[model samples]
Target chain A: MNLRDFRNFTIRDYQDLFAKGELVPRELLTIFLERIREVDSLLHAFLFVNEDRAFARAQKLEEEGRDRSVCPPLWGIPIAIKDNICTLGIPTTCASRILEGYIPPYNATVIERLEAAGAIILGKTNMDEFAMGSSTENSAYGPTRNPFDLERVPGGSSGGSAAALASLEAPLALGSDTGGSVRQPAAFCGIVGLRPTYGRVSRYGLVSFASSLDQIGPMARTVEDTITLFEIISGRDERDSTCAPYPPFSRAEIPQEEEVRKMIIGLPREYFSEGVDSRIVGTIEEVLKGLEKEGLTIREVSLPHTSYALEAYYIVAPSEASSNLARYDGVLYGLREGGEGTLQDMYFRTRTSGFGAEVKRRILLGTYSLSSGYYDAYYLKGMKVRTLVRQDFERAFQECHLLITPVSPVFPFFLGERTKNPYEMYLADVFTIPSAMAGIPALSLNCGYVDNLPVGLQIIAGPFQEGVLFGLALFLEQMLSLPLPLPEIGQQRRS
Target chain B: MPGHVSLEEVRKIAQLAKLSFSEEELTRFFQDISDIIAHFEKLNELDLEDVSPTSHISWSQPPMNPDEPVDWQGSDLVLKHAPCAAGRYFIVPKVVEKEEKLS
Candidate 1:
């Protein structure tokens, strides 16, 4: 099967292929790895690939001869990791020069869990340095092009994870969603992407961006694949104080037919503002109509504070990032350039020279926002607004089962096109940031296409309401006929 | 009615963040920080006399468990990644007197 057809196969299907001994895990993994080798120079989806180690894991699993019911959920499944998540003995650079060649001695808590559940690490995927930008172009390794259109960017900082799944480089991929990093790229790539509720998944090992906003989730080609990976990773961990206890995720079945029409979907007016692409709004209307035909009721709701979320996010994220990134002082876990003079100069030189332009830009912004005189004026005020944003979601969900919106105002833009202006890049995150500010979960699925590129419909649910999100996304998948066609690679080849 | 964030304050923020800047870059940073601060001055005009500052999106309930000192153990296997050392002591840059450095 081609990469397109292969990604459509569920993790269960691939495992069954392995169970019947029809296709060996090593052979299946190599098929995708070879595709990555042949195509990734143009796509730049992966930062590294550990073929030998991945093969070894496959060999061990094969000898064990355990089916998924007895084995782990991820047994023999190849998965892509966002570059920021630390993997033991693998470079966890966060796509920044400051952390060049750095290797972790232990996996991040989520990484440890995924491996224990039977995933084969395909290597780190590209991302915005420090998960700061909306476009993968901010990565020091270079930008990841959208699989659909070569010159266009894969949405960031989880861009590569999304691109890897889109390209069929892996059946499943792991990415962190701070704002829209997971959902936006999943939208642009026409894949099933979920951002689990905050604390639903542990974050002890994921590199800090905005501690309050950050979460790791899965990207795959279908709703079921995303659900399978989520069930495996969601749980509390002692190492992360933020992780909360979850209901047994194994019982998280797709909402049944009897419960189907009971869903209350809300359309927030603030989400479909003047700037949103009309065509996307129209596509969402059609989805709502189709769902209504199937017995789901739709209501128009208001989240007045939604407008301020993007601005509030900029202040709060940078404020936390400014503090969290302090450890990368060319001291621990980064590129350290040895220099003469006091220890201060060594830190000064290493950070100044090592970090790229976008990372430096963010660190500066974050530092100022959290600085002495400005803390309350900027950072504290942002936090107040953040509360309002969260309250907005809480109020809307009071009237509905889920909130639907465009994942992004516009579709993916050409790489280097948006990089020259950072504010423009920030605006792309407007629709996605509200969920992050509120610590709610949102998923992006291909609803329809405009001008041949895919447009994603975002389904948002209140905290710990992933069940609602999965139900609606799966229902839409069966009801909506506009399956996003594969990226037209030939007509849109990258430079 | 307002405190100006001077060019020097902006530069100090960069220094605290471990970012060394050229003279020209420092001047530009000063300008950018000033412009951003000016734009953010809208908050002070809000007449927020009684609003409490919120730090997280979620309400801060008292944590389910109280913080207590624990006798945690560590192995050199993990500690080897620490940046500074003289035996077990983390030898940080001496920014203050030894008395002040006691954490």
Candidate 2:
């Protein structure tokens, strides 16, 4: 096939080609590597490309041969992994200088599952330092640019993975979302991303950011491709105490038209508040109107606690982050500083030098919140407000099967716009943080484009109700029929 | 209970967190963190006296595993990443110092 066809191919299409004996795993790997080489310079999507290991795995898969009945679901598929998730012998830096040159000795449970399912790892993608920033600009290495507009950010923490999929460097990728890490970037890059239920996926290998809110999710170009990867990565693992005792998710069938027609969709009024850009509101309304004509019931719902979610998230996330990052002292792995001085001096020097500006800010904020005198007023209050956020979703779901909202307040913003203002960066996550606080599953898909930039529509469901999300996303995908077009960078290279 | 944060408080927090910063950095961080905390003060507006805190959101009981220790085969691999390691043990700066006896 030609370059144009490769850019549009999904996991299912590749699987069909392999089954028909028309393509081999190694050949596909070469095509992906070539595309990455051509465009990665401009996008900066990947931090490391596992060229040798990927070729070896592809060769082994070729030698074993593709036996459709016996082969794993993701057989011969190449996928990108965010830098925060551990992969044995691969550098998992989380885009921070503290983890510079650090290699993991063990694979994260998700990595093990993906490898077992016959997926090949392309390499680790860049992310915000310790996953703290909403934009990828916080990364010490560099920020990943949006594929659609070279000057705009690719939405972040998972920005690298989203940009890679949108540019067709990889068909599938894994990203960890705490707050809007997965969905926001997916919305900005114009691809599909899902933040599974808090315990739906194991967290043994993901670098701890905010333990209560962190979850591994899947990102791809289409809804079905996302489901395939999500089913493989999600399940129970005894290693993580927080992981639920649920069975592995199975591939869900597309719901029939009648089943979808009977469902009621809720629009939380707080998600469409005045802060949201009028263009995004208009785009989502048009999509909702289309769904209404398709026989689905649309109703207004109130989630009163929505305004408090951002404030609570900022406090809670940093507090947990401060505690989780305490392991980075000079005694163990990672960077060491002030070795000639006393132990206390070493710790002070190492942490101060190792972390970036934003990371340091978060660590300091967390330390202040969890300090002895202020614990009750800051940290405790944040958790209590978390309960109110959870209650809001619990009450909303009682009336509707699922909630639909805009993924981000604005479109993919230009780089350096919000970098200097920490509060503005935090505000970008207002729409997605409520579901994260509630520990529910949420999905982001492109609804339409405003001024040539994509608008993301978020679908949220009750705990373990990912099937509902997939069903609605599939229906909306069919209705929108917006194919993954070649991003501007790719188009420029072609010309 | 006070909303205003002093630079002295920022220094104390830095000490507690085991991190040291330059004077310029301390001043900037003091300003930024005070702004963030001032914004977080909005949480106090909600009267959550009757609401209990949610530490975890999962509905399932945390599965209990047997308290068994298993041998790890990757000890060498783990030590390979340590910044200061001698064989299997990690090296650290001296934590104690000699002092003259009290007279």
List the candidates' TM-scores in order. 0.92, 0.97
TM-score of chain B in each prediction: 0.57, 0.88
Candidate 1's displacement at residue A99, Å, is 1.2
Please give the distance, in angstroms, between residue A234's alpha carbon in candidate 2 and its true position after superposition: 0.9
- The number of the candidate with the highest TM-score is 2
Best by lDDT: 2
For candidate 1, give the lDDT of residue A190: 82
Superposition TM-score, candidate 2 onto the true structure: 0.97
Residue A206 of model 1, lDDT score: 94
Residue by residue across A114-206, what tens digits does model 1's lDDT show? 888888898899998888888888888888988888878889889998888877777788999998899998888888788888788888879
* lDDT for residue B68 in candidate 2, whole number 0-100: 94
lDDT of 2 by residue, A300-322 (tens): 99999999989998889999999
User: lDDT at A419 for candidate 1?
Assistant: 65
DockQ per candidate: 0.35, 0.80
**Best candidate according to DockQ:** 2
